[model samples]
Target: MSETRTGIETNPFDRDHYDYSSWFFWVEASEEQKAEQLAQQEQFLRVRPDSSIGERCFISPLAAIQVETLTLGRSSYISGHAYLTGTLLTGPNCTINPFCVIRGNIRLGHSVRIGAHTSMLAFNHTITDPDLPVFKQPTSQRGITIGDDVWIGSHVMVLDGITIGDRAVVGAGSIVTKDVPAGAIVAGNPATVRKWRVPELAPPTAASVPSSGPVPSGGPVSSGGPVPSGDPALAEQLRAFDQMVREQAEEVLARSWDAATGRYVDAPGHAPSVRAHCDAIEVAAYLTGDVPSQLSREEHVAWLRGLQDPASGMIAELDASGHPGPRVTDLSVDDAHYHVLCVGYALEVLGSSLPHPIHAVDELGADGVIALLDSLPWRGSPWRSSNVADMLGTAVLWNTRAGTPHSAATAAGLFGWLHTHVDPRTGMWGADDPRSGRLETVNGFYRTARGSFAQFGLPLPHPERVVDTVLAHAQDARYFAADRQNACNVLDVAHPLWLAGRMSDYRQQEIRQVAARLLADALSHWRPGEGFAFAADSGTGRDPLAETPGLRGTEMWLAIVWYLADLLGVSRSLSYRPAGVHRPEPAGSLTSQ
Candidate 1:
C-alpha cells in the first residue's frame, strides 16, 4: 500500500497550503485585530486633521501622536522627532526644534524657540533616607513657564518650577535650576544673565546726531588684533611684578594687629588709606590660622558686635581718627571718595571670615548700613565718572545682605531701577540723570554694573525688552571691539556677553565665540615673569596702565581670570584625601613658612 504514488504533489492548493492561509485569515478576521486596524486608521486621520495650520506652527509626524492635543499660534514650527507630552499650551509664533523632550505641565508665549535635544522636565523627587535607593523615592511635579520670544539653545535642561521671561536667551548646554528674569540672557548650571540686550544706535534726530568725526580711543589704542610678538622680557617683568605684589601684600599683612576688643585692625599709618584698610582685613583673616567660628553661636556673635558701628550700622575705618592729631580730618567719614568701597570691602571680609550660617551680613545685624545704601542717590553719571564704581559696589553689598523679606524686596527694586537706566547701545550703566533712563548716555555705567551683577545672583528684570533693544544696536561689528570704551575689553563685558549668549536664541553662538576669544586674548597677555599687564599692548606703550600698574589693575586681572575659568567650566585637579601625605601650607596661607 506504499501504493502507486500519486503523480501530483499532494494537492498543492489543498488543505496543507490552505491551512497556512486559514491561520492568517482567522487571525486577521479576529475582533482584536480588526479593532487595532481601525484605531491605526483613525490615528492617521487625526494627525493631519486639517492642512490650515497657524504661522510658526510645527507638527512633525514623530512629534504628533494625538495631534488634537498640540495647539500652536502664528509663525511657530516644530521639527521632527520632538516628543512633547502632557498639555502644550502655547502663545503666538513659537518654534519647537528637533529632538526636544518636553513633559508634564508647560506653557510658552509668543516667538519662542526650543533647540534640539533640550529637555524640559517638570518633576522632582523627595528623598527621606540617606541610604535608600533613589528609585524608591516619592516624586513631585512643578510646571514650566516660558515668556514671549524666548530662545533656548540645544542641550538646555530646564528643571521643574522655573519661569523663563520674555525675550530671554538660554545658551547651549545650560542647566537652568532657577527662575530667569524677563529680558535676561542666562547660562551655566544655575543660569544667570551676564548682560542685557540693548539697541545699537540712538534714534536719528535733529538734535542727537554727532557733529564730530569718528570717536577717538579713550584709554589704550592698539591695532585691534592678536599680539604678534611674544617677548620673554615681558614675561620676566611679570615674574618680577608678582614678587613685588607678594612682598607688598606680606608687608601689609604684618601691619595688621589685634585691637583691645580682640578684632583685627590696620596698625597706625595703614588705617587712613582705603587700600590699606581693605588689605589689612583681607590679610588678617587669611593669617588667622583658625577655623571660622560658628556665626549663630555666642562666640562669633560677640566678635561681630565688636566690629559694628553703633550709630550708622557701619564699621569704623580705624580705632582712632589719628594717632596724635587733635582734628579727626585724616580719618573723617565724610570723605565720599572711598566710603562706599570701604563699606563693601568690610562687608565682604566679614562675610568670608564668618561661618557659613553667618555669611550674610544683613542677617548678622547691619540695618544702618543697608539704610545708608538705600538713601544714597545714584551718582556716577555720564558712565565713566568717579562714583560709578561705588554705585556698583553698593549694589553688590545689598544683594548679599541677608535680612527680612521686605529688605530683600527693597534690594530687588533697587536693582530693577538700576537696570532700567542701562544704555541700550553699549550695555553700560550710569547716566547723568538716572530718571531720564536713556540707554545711549549711560553705556559705560551699564557695562560695569552688568558685570558686577553677574557675580552675585540677582535676576535680570525684563530681559526680553532689554535684549531686543541691545541686539538692534549690535549690527556693527565694531561694537564688539575689545577696547576699554566698549563693553568687549573688560571682564564685565566678557561675563555679560557669555551670559547673553546662553539665554538668547539669536546671538548665542556669536556672543560665546566673542567672549571666549576676548578671554583668551586677555589671558595671553599674562607674563609668567611679570604680573598680568592691563592689556596686550602693555610693554608696547599702547596701554594706559603700563606706566603705573598697581593693586587695582592686578586685582582686576585676578578676578577676571577666576571668573573666566569658572565660565569655561574648568575645575581644580587637586582632591582631599585623609591618608595622603601632608604638604606645607601655601605662601598665601597665614601660617606659611
Candidate 2:
C-alpha cells in the first residue's frame, strides 16, 4: 500500500506493467474522465527505480525523468515532456508544468505551481576569462529552494541558488536571480520584488509540504536525516525503500557467488576478481547476515590463501591454470596494494587472517619509510600517495596477529611523514588548484587519510578543516552531479565527511543535509533485487541497464549508504556499521598499540 494513495487504488505493480498513460491523469474535466480509475503500482513502474514516491503522484508517460534522486510528494503533478534530471525533492500537490527544464538540484514546496516553459538550472558555468569557451569552464551548484504555496508563472527562469519564499508569486517571463520574499509579486529580468501581498487578505496557511523532497530549511547546504521525512507517510515509504535495498544485498552476493572457486566473479562469464570477492564478503558481513554463498569455510579460506605471494606477502589473482602468476595487470583487482585492505579485511570478517606476513616493505625503519614517502607524488595525485598506507596498515594488522615488530616502526615513520606534509589550510595532502580544482586533492585526502590515519586509529591533525574541504567540494557541479557521480567519487566525498564527523561538529547540520541528499541519490541508482551498477544510465558510460550490477560499485555503495545514514544519526536503522573498506570505526592495530 502507498503511504498516501498509489496512482491506482490497487494493483500498481501488476505483472502486466500498468500503463502510466491509463492514469497519466484521470483528474481532468468530468465525463471525459471515464478512463480515470485509481491505479496501484510500484514506485519503479512510473518514476525512477529505488525511489520512495508518494501516492496519487501523476507523472506523464512522456516525462523525461533522468533525475537520479527524486521523491515526488503525495498528489504531485508533473506534466509531459518535463526534462527533470539531477536531484529534485518536492512537497505534495506540486505542479511541474510541461517543458519545465529542471536541469539539476531543486527543491519544491507543496501545492506549488510552475508554468510552462520554466527553466530551473541549479549550477552555473564559470566564465571568468573572455578567451575561454563556456563549455570548457567548470560549474558550481548552490541549488534552488521553493517554499510552500508558491506560484511560478510561464517562461520564468530560476537561476542557481535562488529561494522563493512561501506563498510567493513569480510573474510570467520573470528571471529569478535573487531571493523572492514571501507573499511578494516579482516580475522582470532579474525578478525583483514589486509589492508584498497583505497578510490579512492572504490565503489561509496551507498544510506544510511533507518533506517528500524537503529542502534544507535553513543553515548550511549539508544536514543529516533519512529521507526528508516531516510526514508519517514519508517515514513509512523510507522504511520500505530501505527494506528493498537490504534485500538486494542478498541478491548481489547470491548471483555473484562462485561455488567452484569459493569466490565471486564480476558476472557469470567474467573472470573471478580478488577485490570483488573481498568486497562481496565485506558487504555480506556488514549488511546481510549468512548470505548462503554455499562455499565451505575451508574452501573459501584455501582459495584466498592460494592467491598470496609468499615472497612479497601480498595477494594477487591466479592465472588460467589456477595458480598465482607474475603477469602484471593494470587493474585495481590486480593491484597488490589494494588487495591488502579489501582482501585483508575480507579475511578478517570471515574469521581468518592473511595467510602470510606482509613483507612488501618489511624491516623498514623511520628513515627508510620517510625516504620512500618523500619520493611519492604527494603534490600530484593524493590517491597515489595513499597507496602505501594500505601496505602499512596491512603490515600492522597482519603483524599484530603474527607477532612481528616491523609494523610499529613503519607505521610510526609513515605517520610522521603524513603529519609533516599535510597542508594545514585544506587539511589535505595538496592545496586546491584555486583556478579549476576538481576536488582531486580533497578526494585524495580521504583516500590517503583512510589508509594511514583512520586506519591505525590516529586522529587527523585538523579534522574540522577536512569537513570544510569535503563539503565545499560537494558544492561543485562538475564532480558531485548525477552525470559525474560514480561509486568512487561518491565514496570519496562520503568517507571524508563521515570520518571528520567522528572528530568535530563544525558543520554538523550541513553534513546531515548532505547525508539525506546522497542517501536518496545512492538509492536511486539501485536496481531492486539486482543491486547497483558502477554508474547509472546517465553515468560516464558504465550503464547498469545494459550490463550486470558491478561488485565494486554495489559493495562500496551499500557501505557508503551506511556511512550516509550514520551521518544522519540513523545508522542504527541500517542495523550494522560497515566493517569493509569504508568502516567507520578504526582498526585494532598492533602498530597503534
Q: Which ten residues in a row have the lowest lDDT in candidate 2?
A: 217-226
Give me the displacement of residue 366 in model 1, in angstroms. 18
What is the model-wide C-alpha lDDT for candidate 1? 0.41
Which residues of candidate 1, in runs, are more than 4 Å off? 1-272, 276-309, 314-413, 419-456, 462-489, 527-530, 533-537, 540-547, 566-593
lDDT of 1 by residue, 1-593 (tens): 01111233545344222112222322333455334434643555466332123432334434543322344444455555677765455545566776788875466755678888899985567587768887887554445667556799999999865667555789999998765645557788877655544211111232322111001111000111111222345334434533454444444343343343333333422234333334333332322211122222223323433443433333334434422222222212444334344434433333221111112223323343344434444353444431433333343333333222234443444455456655554444433444434333334433443423432323344333344444433333443344322212354444343344333333434443444555555555543323344444434455454423232333345445433332332201101100000000000100100
For candidate 2, the TM-score is 0.57
Worst 10 residues of 1 by lDDT: 578-587
Model 2, span 1-593: residue lDDT tens: 11213344435364222122223354432332322322323534355333445566666555787765565666776776789876676656788877889976576756788988899997778797889999998665555767667799999999875667656789999998766645568899977766655342222222321221122211111122112333344345456766676566677777776667655776555667777777777666544443235565445555666677776677766554345657333222326778777776665554345666776555666677788778777677656666665566556556544445676776678788888888888888865565547466876787787777666555678888888888888888776776556777778888887766654546777877877787778878877666777765474455543335767777777778767765664544443445556755344433222
TM-score of 1: 0.36
Q: What is the C-alpha lDDT of each candidate?
A: 0.41, 0.63
The CA root-mean-square deviation of candidate 1, after full C-alpha superposition on the true structure, stands at 22.9
Q: Once superposed on the true structure, which residue ranges of model 2 sit more than 4 Å away at CA?
A: 1-238, 258-263, 320-323, 327-334, 433-436, 539-548, 589-593
